[model samples]
Target: MNRRDNAPGASADIGAALYGLATRAARRLPRDMSLTSAATLATLDRTGPRRITDLAAVEGITQPAMTTLVRVMEKSGLVERRGDASDKRVTLVCLTEAGASYVRTRRQAGVHAFERLISELTGDEVEALVAALPALKHLADLESQDREGQNQ
Candidate 1:
């Protein structure tokens, strides 16, 4: 058996290594867009329209901070707000067509960055990365669900 299999802190070590690899690839991408903006757009794309409060919670930021981000995105013509039909007091933020296109652009850049990294890896490593994608997505979904449950 590998020494890691018997180590008490092996899981954390592995997690850190994987996180480092992802961070490295992310760092290679252009810094034209802030991470917060990309994350906000990505969240809206994944979850559809959401109230400002909900978006703040999902993004793990203060409601006021999210409001500021929304204002900036609105000014950039990437998002728009409308009063909730069921609750006039609440406002929902939705991505504009431009915003969706921006997300696609940002996603493609990240994909290209990772693809470059993949080119440096062996065939077996690339296969392992592909196999791990589903599990990574599941982990992400579960973590978000857990946070939402806590917020409620």
Candidate 2:
């Protein structure tokens, strides 16, 4: 039997709607940045400086690719490499002030887009989305935990 036929409680509809919402909101946002660069900047902002190998694992990209990305970001003055205090042989990728500001602007653009979308929604619709916030955060936490488990 098809999985959709199995239960009324399935999240297929929610998944599709959320995906649509996310895609539409993203499309409406004004930005000329690649997702990888945005995500990398956001990661460094969120997690602080980390080794390129660790960044590669977190981003699901190859180390060499991350090295290239870091090089480009460094050239752009978006990031910097530093010696690890505890390990002289290790290098850490850090977000420069410009990089952090860029991440902040990127995040604000997304928030502005979402806020506009929410303003167009009806009161009940907005309330439903507000109610769903906890569940969404829980899902995010689950994903993070799963990623951590994979690293271990």
Index of the highest-lDDT prediction: 1
Clashes of each: 0, 0
Q: What would the TM-scores of all predictions be?
A: 0.83, 0.86
Give per-residue CA lDDT, model 1, range 92-119, as digits (tens). 9999999999989888988887778789
* CA-lDDT, candidates in order: 0.87, 0.85
lDDT of 2 by residue, 31-144 (tens): 666667677888899889999998888888899999998998899999999999999999999999999998898889788877877899999999998998999999878977
Model 2 segments more than 4 A misplaced = 1-9, 27-31
